[model samples]
Target: MLDISKLERRWLKYKIKKILPYTLLITTVTILGFTIPFVLSNRHSSKAMIPLKKDAIKVKAPNTENDEGAMVLEPSMHFIESMDTPSTPITNTPTSSTKPAPTPKHSIAPIASLPTPTPAIAQTQATKAPQPIVKGKLTSIKRDDTAFDIHEIEDRFKDTSNPNLGVYIAKYHYDHGNYSEAYNYALKTNSINNSIDDSWLIFAKALVKLGKEEQAKKTLQLYISNSNSQAAKNYLDTLDKGGSK
Candidate 1:
């Protein structure tokens, strides 16, 4: 029995010696697994407690020098609080319409025509009553032989004091084969202005045309004596020879 007991003790000692190294290795690995993660978690928590700048936020960055999934702290962006009210989104879609708007049109107004003003001489002639001699003389004068219309000249004739108008009237009558009217107008011209030689010559010629040759010569002689007019002298010599004007 003593021999058997000694053998059993030796075998048990041998088994314990062989298993002890593997037991220590498994125990150390398990402890390190738990302790290393706890240490890493504490390190990260310390980094989170570090002072941060205003408006700054912390973010996790990969740590290349450590384990594959390990993370470290870094200031990545700004932080803002969420608004209490949400903003409405804006869309750029255009609206549709059935018809287009019409363009505007401009309207023009017509201008009114004004009446022509009458001349001062025309107004004066309108106010005067027509004399019978003037009416008869206007009717008898040949309108075709006159340079201007008879009515136009008659308008200027209203200003009797104008000797130029009287002379023009006398010349118009004489050129148109109206001897009686020529005599009247020519005499009227001389009455207004005796300096007009045309009126004197027309007066003498009108007398000759009216069958008063003696009277025509006597009038020419009288005019020549007063004015020393060569024209009047020539006319008087023609009348003396019984020549018609």
Candidate 2:
């Protein structure tokens, strides 16, 4: 009544259906895990064994003659062979050929000899009339006689009441080494004409020459205020240094 054959066949079909799904899943997982890593490892090993192709560019090393310790890289044979070679030799020729001109030679003529003259002829030639030497009279120039007397000028100026004449007399006396006379005349000129800078200057100079340094310095300083006179300033500087004018 149990029908064991049919029951056994149903049990076998149920087990095959359940186990086939598990077997297919396990086979798929195993194949994925083992085949993927093997394929990746084989690809990596093939790449490592193969050589890489590089560009045929030539690299030149820097010149190291100036740098004694510099490292120089040697060029490879492939790099040398890749460089362009000359197909023909170059020749340079001038378009025109020039020849140098020859130098010219100058011919010199021989000098002629003169005949000797007789002693009588030589004496006659030497004795040919000597020129007369005329002596000129020496004229004496009297410079002192031509000069006008100061006494005469003083007499003439006594009649003329000219301040400039006084100034001129003062300068003339000062130039002639008469300091007392120059001082008197200069004082009179400056009193008559206060604007006469030359009179003040001559007065100061006469005072300095007469050994009156203090009076001369005072007179020059007073004159310099209105005139800004360089000579007066220089004279004052000389006095300050205790130097003679």
CA lDDT of every candidate: 0.51, 0.54
List model 1 lDDT by residue over 41-88, tens digit each: 999887766645321332222222342322222221110000011110
**TM-score list, all predictions:** 0.39, 0.40
Per-residue error (Å), model 1, residue 198: 0.7
> After best superposition, candidate 1 residue 32: deviation in angstroms?
99
Please count the clashing residue pairs in each candidate, in the order shown. Answer: 0, 0
Residue pairs in collision within model 1? none
Q: Write the per-residue lDDT of candidate 2 for residues 133-212, one digit (tens) a residue.
A: 33453322112210244454455556553665666567556655689998998898788767655567668778988999
Q: Model 1: residues >4 Å from true position, as ranges?
A: 1-148
Best model per TM-score: 2
Q: What is the lDDT of residue 109 in candidate 1?
A: 8
